[model samples]
Target: MSTISSASSSTTTASRPTARNLGPKPQDNRIPVTPAVLRGIFASSRTPLEERSISRVAFFRFTGFLLSCLGIAWAAARGRGIKNSAALLGVV
Candidate 1:
């Protein structure tokens, strides 16, 4: 009984997460695009859009962003200000 109590008392609680103990920071794999890079990408014929899938991926991502923005605007306008059906139609 004394040995069990001693063993339990000897065990330490888990330490909190510290910067040193925690593993290395997570890496972001995405390439950041600037306006100049975008202009170069669009203007340069050297870029083989056919050879890569990045264009298609970018197109869908951009389309989704636009749609989400539109939905948010519609919700904000209708949720608070618009009450009547005619006003809602006008908003649409």
Candidate 2:
């Protein structure tokens, strides 16, 4: 291969993903327009009661995430491994 050469084999060997090759940083996914953040986003424009109302997208997404986590936990408790639990969840 281009990366593995005969000269290198005659001297020192190279291993991939070395110390300096740590992958990209994990992304902290903060929702830009979630229901909870609405109060802060529209604090000046809207009344407190109006800002308290939740966004439909945010509500569904939060509920879905919560339910999916609960289902995975339940499946794991039943002795199903991650792969199997994920497959079972796909069917559900």
Candidate 3:
């Protein structure tokens, strides 16, 4: 039947990858480790502790700023709300 023929063609097409026709493959172990690449890797690997120290400092500063803002907003709101209530009660 036509259904069986189409299914067989679809299976054959799907099983073949298209990359095989692109080009010849390069050598796997022939990659050159140049001086710049070596230096970049060494610098990246050596800076983890320094990066952690900088990140901690930045986090501490950010948290302190957020806490200060929250504290200021809370104090302002509480003060205004209490004043309004006291004024309504004829106490201020």
Count of backbone collisions in candidate 2 = 0
Query: Against the true structure, candidate 3 has what lDDT?
Result: 0.79
- Give candidate 2 regions above 4 Å deviation: 1-54, 80-92
Q: Write the per-residue lDDT of candidate 2 for residues 27-63, one digit (tens) a residue.
A: 6465567785875666768776655564656788899
Model 1 agreement with the true structure over 1-92: per-residue lDDT tens digits: 99988777666333446567877556656678999889787657555755356678889999999999989878976777876666756766
Q: Residue 72 in candidate 2 has what lDDT?
A: 75
* TM-score ranking, high to low: 3, 1, 2
Highest TM-score model number: 3
What tens digits encode model 3's per-residue C-alpha lDDT throughout 4-27? 999999999998879767665687
Clashing pairs in 2: none
Candidate 3 or 2, higher lDDT: 3
Q: lDDT of each prediction vs. the true structure?
A: 0.73, 0.69, 0.79
Give the lowest summed-lDDT range of ten residues in model 2. 80-89
The reply for model 3, stretches above 4 Å from the true place, is 1-46, 82-92
Runs off by more than 4 Å, candidate 1: 1-51, 83-92
Please report how far candidate 2 places residue 83 from its true position, in Å: 20
lDDT-best of 1 and 2: 1
The root-mean-square deviation over C-alpha atoms between each candidate and the true structure, in angstroms, is 9.8, 14.5, 12.7
